[model samples]
Target chain A: MKLVISIAGDNLQSPFDARFGRAAAFCLVDSDTGAWTAHANPALEAAGGAGVQAAQFVAGLGARAVVSGAYGPKAYASLSAAGIAMHLAPGNAPRTAADVLAQFQAGALNQAQAATQDGRH
Target chain B: MRIVVASGKGGTGKTTVATSLALVGGESVRCLDCDVEAPNAALFLHPVLDRRQEVGIPLPRVDTALCTHCGKCAEVCQYHAIAVLGQTTLVFPELCHGCGSCTRLCPEAAITEHLHVTGVLEGGLTADGLEFARGLLQVGEPMAVPVIRELKRWPPLRRPALEIWDAPPGASCPVVETLRGADFALLVTEPTPFGLHDLKQVVGIARALEIPAGVVVNRDGIGDQGVDAYCADQGLPILLRIPMERRIAEGLARGRSLLETAPDYRPAFQALLAAIQDRVNTEYAP
Candidate 1:
């Protein structure tokens, strides 16, 4: 399974970004092979509907799951419809994407069951 | 001539000036309270509303039986108002702007337009023989332009008479929409730094839209002369300066027009109207 994690920088050592749509970059990791690739988030500077756009971007990349601080209603709806799982990262603290992926592998993170009201438009 | 009474900041006496002008202008004046988010000109004008019409926007309703689940509507929606999930498609009405693009672009012809009520348009006559109209937006509605458009398109609005529009605050889309096609714009501002900052934005919008505009400094004596200096530098006419008075505030609180309570202030409003007409005539001369 491939997992996409929102990040502030374009490297595995970059801190995990809490925001899903406005994140500067996304790190796509292959869970079985432990290989990862970084892509710039095109929705970072969108005027509106950034969350849904980001969800579409990851879904197009065939990501099975997404890790972020929260998911808006539109983003949640898109991801849920595409059968992609959502997991909540730890707070806004400076944790690397690699650390988050490891936490997910160790079952230390919580899976999001529904969309959060944190940043719904 | 159409004169829009607008302000960059709220609570700057826009309705006070607008209603006062409508009252002083009398039988030939028609007032439209275009601030649909919070219509308050009627509170002061006290117009007897005898007509009410529902204002609606065309929202898309998907016919699930005919939908191909191709997600074309979701792809075309800029607001993310629609999400096509497998065999199910969901519509978020509040997020929809009723642009009808999705309905038109649907390849399977499964989308149909449905009327969604956004607000109500009301028309009536004030006790003093002035024509009055206002748009009241429904609670929690994000868009007010549809209601304002309906109010502007009302038959009485196009009649041969003096038209005064009390626009909403801020230089956003709604303000631009209200100021469009007006012969003159009366920018109301208080004499303060924040007031001056926002006034500059509204003025910029008016100048960009190529509408001739003047300034009305409400609460004139309370703050410094920054607004005055800015207007002077811009060469914009200072139409009127209403002095800051506790009596004016008290009267407004009781929903009374300054023209009715003070009576002496009626001339100022009338002069303001005349100045607007004169400027429009001179600047727009053939």
Candidate 2:
């Protein structure tokens, strides 16, 4: 399964970014092989609807799950409709993207059923 | 002649100057408050609304039966208002600008348009024989351009009347829509840095639209002369300078026309109109 994590830098060791749509970069990890690739988030500077576009980008990448601090309403709707699971990362303290993936592997994260914030409509 | 009163920064007395202009112009002028998001000119004009009409935008409605999940609508929507997920298509009406691009480009011809109420346009007259109109944008609606467009289209009194538009702040699309085709744009600004910054932006808009514009510096004595210097350098005329006065603020707070409360300010507004007319005539001469 492929998992995508929003991160602040262009590598797996980078700190996990809480924002899903406006994240600086996305780390795509193959769970079975542990192979990871970093891609810049094109929707980061979108004038509007960044969340929806980011969700679409992730879904297009065939990501099975996304790890982030929170998901906006539009992102949540798009991701949920694409059958992609959303997991919440530790927000109070800084965590690396790799740390988030490790926590998810250890079953330390919670799956989000609804959006955490109201996105601009 | 159509003269639009606009400000780069919010709360810089656009309404105060606009209402005072309309008041001083008397029955010869018609006022349209295009600040649809928060129409406050009515508070001072107190026009008795005799006509009201709901304004709406045409949003796309997808016909699922004919839609092949081709994602054409979603692909054509620049605002991400439509999202096509597998066999399902989701439409966010609030984000839609009603451009009809999606409906026109849909391959399956499965998209149709339906009117979504964005606001209301009202027309009436004040007790003093001032014809007034304003647009009230629906709360939570992101779009204001359509409402302003409708307000502009609202017919004024049959006789020739000087149309004065109380424009919304900023150089956004709404302001552009308000200033479009206007004969003159009266930019209202404060003498502060923020005010000067926004003034330059709105002035750029007016210049881009090729509309002659002048400035009205409200609360002139409170801040530095940076705005005046900037306007002078740009060769933009400073039509009026309304000094900072607590009494003017108090009277406005009470929803009283500055022309009525201060009386002395009436001549200033009148001269402001004359200056605007002079600039418009020289620039637009045949």
Which has the greatest TM-score? 1
TM-score of chain A of each: 0.95, 0.96
Give the TM-scores of the predictions, in the order they appear.
0.94, 0.91
Quality class of the docking in candidate 1, CAPRI style: acceptable
Q: Indicate which candidate wins on DockQ.
A: 2
Candidate number achieving the greatest lDDT relative to the actual structure: 2
Q: Give the lowest summed-lDDT range of ten residues in model 2 chain B.
A: B153-162
**Which residue pairs in candidate 2 collide?**
none
User: Which segments of model 1 are wrong by more than 4 Å?
Assistant: B85-88, B157-160
List model 2 lDDT by residue over A25-86, tens digit each. Answer: 89999977889999999888877778878888888788999999999998888888888999
The residue pairs in collision within model 1 are none
Question: For candidate 2, what is the DockQ?
Answer: 0.54
lDDT of each candidate versus the true structure: 0.88, 0.89
